[model samples]
Target: MRKRIVRYLLALLGIGAIGAAVFLFMFIRPLPVEVARPAEAVPVQVFGLGTVEAHILSKIGFEVGAALVELNADHGDRVSQGDVLARLHNGEQQARVARAKAGVVNGEAAVKMAQAAVGKARAVLAQKKLTNERKQALLSRQTVSVESAEESQMEVDVAAAELAVAASDVDVAKAALEDARAQYQLETVLLDHHVLKAPYNAIVVERHKELGSVLAPGEALFTLVAPETVWALAYVDEARAGDIRVGQPAEVRLRSLPRQMFEGHVTRIAIESDRVSEERRVYIACDHCPDRFHLGEQAEVFIRTAALDKALLVPETAVEGFDGTKGVVWTVEDGDLRRREVTFGNRTLDSRLEITGDLPDGAQVVTTLHPGLREGRAAKVTEEAAP
Candidate 1:
């Protein structure tokens, strides 16, 4: 009986060993997989966060001071050169002009009167000369006493003095007329100042004063902006600014309008960066501006500093770590996984990468996440179907 029990225990041990061997064979080894090839991708260098902007902007102000009696413009109003924008109360100015005109008329009448007086003075002088001649003749002929002739000559002298005074009065009156005319012309000009007109074609962006509101000189009445003259001011990093130059092609996208892409060119670059922000100011001129754009709108600019074509590319996901630092990739060669060290260039917007190394174009790369993936290891690179 003891011998039979030993035989049964020996048979059970043999069966257990066979079952463990079968389990190891079925589950311990890795399953064979089909390796995927790297895709043929067109390399593209793209930039984002750009903006659209105006070429120029400015604030318009008034030169004269007065109450705003009328406003012909408001925000978003289009104006042309010499268009009346506003007006001031002109009652006082008009009254002063009327008074000045009346003074001119009075002066003109005074000049006429003085001219008549001068005519009378000339006649009196002629009569006195004739009388003086007669007096001299009488004295020479001894027809009258010498004292009587002397008295007649003295009367002639008095008449000549009176005529000289009248002539001087006429000259004074003429000068007064000229002064009055000048005053009238000056008043007329001031009276015209009541109306304010635009100096150029522009769009009003702001209205600082309302009707019946008093405004001081040099105060802003309405702010006008020339949409055609608008430009974009961008703040670029100081490190990347060295590659930027005037006249380089650039792309801009406004924060407010993201769907639209506006082309532009670099017009200027600041020589110095901000001391605190360490950002350089870049000015860009838009290729074409819309019919209107608001001033001071924030924008992002992309300056195409460099370009490359027909370069070998890979999926951005193949590059390891942030910004491809410590960059590593699992490339499939002969159906086996091999780690590759790659040097990356500018990244494209579509998650494609520009890579430089011995990696061949259209080479297979392992993109699926797997455990224990290393050099000379078996891996299945599942092809990510393209959209």
Candidate 2:
């Protein structure tokens, strides 16, 4: 009985060992993977993060300080140039304008009174001159006393002096009238300042000051943006920004509308790069952007730089030791894995690298870096797939 029990235990141990061997062979022997082939020349693109911005963004404010009385424009409201946007407590300004007008009227009356004084002085001087002439004539004929003639000449002199003073008064009155008119015009301009008007056709982004609020000079009342001037502002890395040029086609996707892609073209490229981040700002103008857009909305952009009819392409994951323009990739050679040094050209939006070097056509490249994969290792084309 002891020999039989030992034999049964040995048999069970052998069965367990066989099961473990089969399990390892089925599950852990060789890794099953997808293989990639050099694809036909595809379009290469540069990716960037961006935001919606307006070329004409304005912070609307009051030029002069006053108490806000009425707000004609609100957030999200559409406005046109010269549209009344807001109003301040302009009662005092109106009163001042009226007072200025009254002063102008009083100045006109003063000018008329000065003119009348000049006219009266002229008439009196003419009469005095006539008397002086008659007295001189009479004295020449010895018909009047010399004292009388001298008195007549003195009277004429006094009358002439009075007329000159009247003319000077008229000139002073005219100057005073000009000053009053100038004050009236200044007051009218100030009164207009109390009523703020929109400077351009725009959409109100924000209403900063509420009605009945006191505002200082240059205090922002509303933020406005020109809807037609909206565009995408993207930042591209300096390395990739070298090839970017104005008028390049781009695809933009807004965070708010993820599924929708907007078509655009490059409009501007900044000459100066960001010192800290090493990025350059690029502006793109959308062909048919949405009618409504939130300013500063996050966006993603892809700019197509080049398109090739036929070129060797490989998955970026299969590459190693990449140094910007060059990298090493694992290629299947005679069903064996081998590393090849390749110089890269434009990169695709889907992370595919364009190999410009003489890589054999229809060569199978590994899509991933798998462990135990090395040079001269036998590899079977398991899953031939393209992503």
Q: If scored against the real structure, what TM-score would every candidate get?
A: 0.58, 0.73
Residue range 83-166, candidate 2, lDDT tens digits: 999998888889999999999999999999999999999999999999999999999999999999999999999999999999
Index of the highest-lDDT prediction: 2
* True-structure RMSD, every candidate: 9.2, 6.6
Q: In model 1, how large is the Cα lDDT of residue 20? A: 86
Instruction: Report the lDDT tens digits of candidate 1 across residue range 1-387.
Output: 999999999999999999888765544434233333333434332342323444434555555577888889998988998999989888898899999999999999998998898889889878888987987898899988899888888888888888888889889998999999999999988877778888788888889889999877677788777767677888876644666778888777777787886887888877877899777888888887555576677777777765654554556665676355336776777766677776776555466566666565555655444555656655544444341
- Could you tell me the lDDT of residue 174 within candidate 1? 88
Error of 1 at 35 (Å): 26
Model 1 score (lDDT): 0.71
Q: How much lDDT does candidate 2 score?
A: 0.87
